[model samples]
Target: MASTTPTQIDQAPPVTSSGRSTGRAGDKIFAGLSKGSGILLLVIMASIAGFLTYRASIALSKNEGNFLTTFDWNASANPPVFGIAVLLFGTVVSSIIAMAIAVPIAVGIALFISHYAPRKLAAPIAYVVDLLAAVPSIIYGIWGALFLVPQLNGLNLWLDEYLGWTYVFDKTQVGVARSLFTVGILLAIMILPIVTSVSREVFLQVPRMNEEAALALGATRWEVIRMSVLPFGRSGVISASMLGLGRALGETMAVATVLSPSFLINGHILDPGGGTFAQNIAAKFDEANEFGRDALIASGLVLFLLTLLVNGAARLIIARRKDFSGANA
Candidate 1:
């Protein structure tokens, strides 16, 4: 038997100009498409920001109230007084409350689905969670307004009675619990499914070998999860929580339906009135004139900036942890 020479073994296959040109053309087309898409996204974002800033400047110039500190929103007045203090307070407070409630519950549910649940039960539960994520926000709003508000009255009373010393829970006046706290609860329920789904997916991706090693070292199921799963999924959970936070921040209908709009800043979240940015816009848009619309756009710009800041912070945290995780691995 004759052995092949080195040159013969290392010989390159013949290439046709037609095939090479076709491949080059395909590559150029794909590269152009991707570049164009990214440019288009940047352009769209810039356009939105520029338009909002221009309108906001016009409205601010005509304003009779401090934009940052004033509580009233009377844009239709001759001097057109308006400010975002109340809206900012409500938006941030409600979002914080929602995050505090939602994140832990979501993590627990994700853990249960990923590790604790019976194999037979996990699939169905996960399916239900996915279904819940797809349910319309308007449905949540309607349910929150008609059913949740009434149902929460007892709990609200109980909290005010027991936890009123906290001041945040204190309800001085007699009224329904159509407040920021209620809105927070509603937002928690609305965001729960998405967070759980994302966290579960992350947990499920944990390497089985890592868990098995922990088990072999006499670690219990919870111990294995703590040592292996949680660390691997920390970034994912953070991302999921941020997604839920964004949803809570921008939610309109549910907040509008559940919250009795007020332009005042109240520390008591169980009381009957507080307002969020999206809720404020939705509630006042139809009655607003051109200047009023500009003011709303300005508020929207604030919301947009807030979301960007949150996402940027989360990315920074993830980047910092990436090196630590890589080193440990």
Candidate 2:
């Protein structure tokens, strides 16, 4: 064989004085646009939050009691004073209930869709879930009010008869399903599709190599998912839960229509008391006096804060998890 001649090497283009190449202008513009958009969003969010907080502070300053701590929602009184404690309690409780009911079912549905289900079955089911998510919230409210409420009342009645010993199932035979429990159940149903869809997407992203490796190691399907899939997708599940909580917290018409908006906060889920922030706002916005409206705004501010806190916590958890996983890897 003839001796091979050495190939010529192409010299790299010279770098600009600014440490960037001429070809990077488009990239720099794109990055600047992206960062500018993010800054604009942050500014808009901050403005809205500041306006709401300012209004809430004005309303709160006029009230006699410490608005944050007091449980009474007597915003329409002679003194025109009240607190969001009841609303906060209701919001937190209802959201917790919604997350509890939606998350497990959503995760199970996601697992089934991404892994266990046959291809033919998956498409139709996925379409159905998407359809469910697209359905108008008002439609959900009406259907929930007319259809689900009565059906649930029947279920509640059965539970009353059989499981009333448990505090959750106790019912006072109200003519309508206007309780926190009913609202929470409806919220769970409304948010289930969102959680399931997100979780399905997350689970689908689980590396094929991981699954194949587990199987090659003689792990069963369920065991493989339990070890490799779940741990990987756990952060995604938490993010989905937080997203669902945000929806549940901000939900207005559905909860308003489904629940009885009493100022009183009752520990019993079955009791016809306790009103969430969005419910309180929706129920009273039209009829509420100026003070009542401002008080509602104050309650909304709390809810906004609560949602921000929840989302932040979720992000932090995901970040820490990524860090730990990265270090391990």
TM-score for all models, in order of appearance: 0.89, 0.85
Against the reference, the lDDT scores of all candidates come to 0.89, 0.83
Residue-level lDDT of model 1, residues 1-329, one tens digit each, is: 24667667568655545355677788999999999999999999999889988988888888899999999999988888899999999999999999999999999999999999999999999898888888898899999999999999999999999999999999987888799999999999888998999899988978787778889999998999999999888888998888888888999998999899989999998988889999999999999999899888888889988988887877776676566455335
Backbone clash count, each prediction separately? 0, 0
Query: What would the TM-score be for candidate 2 when compared with the true structure?
Result: 0.85
Name the lDDT value of residue 282 in candidate 1.
Answer: 96
- Score candidate 1 by TM-score against the native: 0.89
Highest TM-score: which candidate?
A: 1
- Give the alpha carbon lDDT tens digit for every residue of 97-201 in model 2: 888899999999999999999999998998898788888888888888888877876777777778888766677646676778878888998899989998899
Best by lDDT: 1
Q: Report how far off residue 226 is in candidate 2 (Å).
A: 1.5
Return model 1's CA RMSD, one decimal.
4.9
Worst 10 residues of 2 by lDDT: 1-10
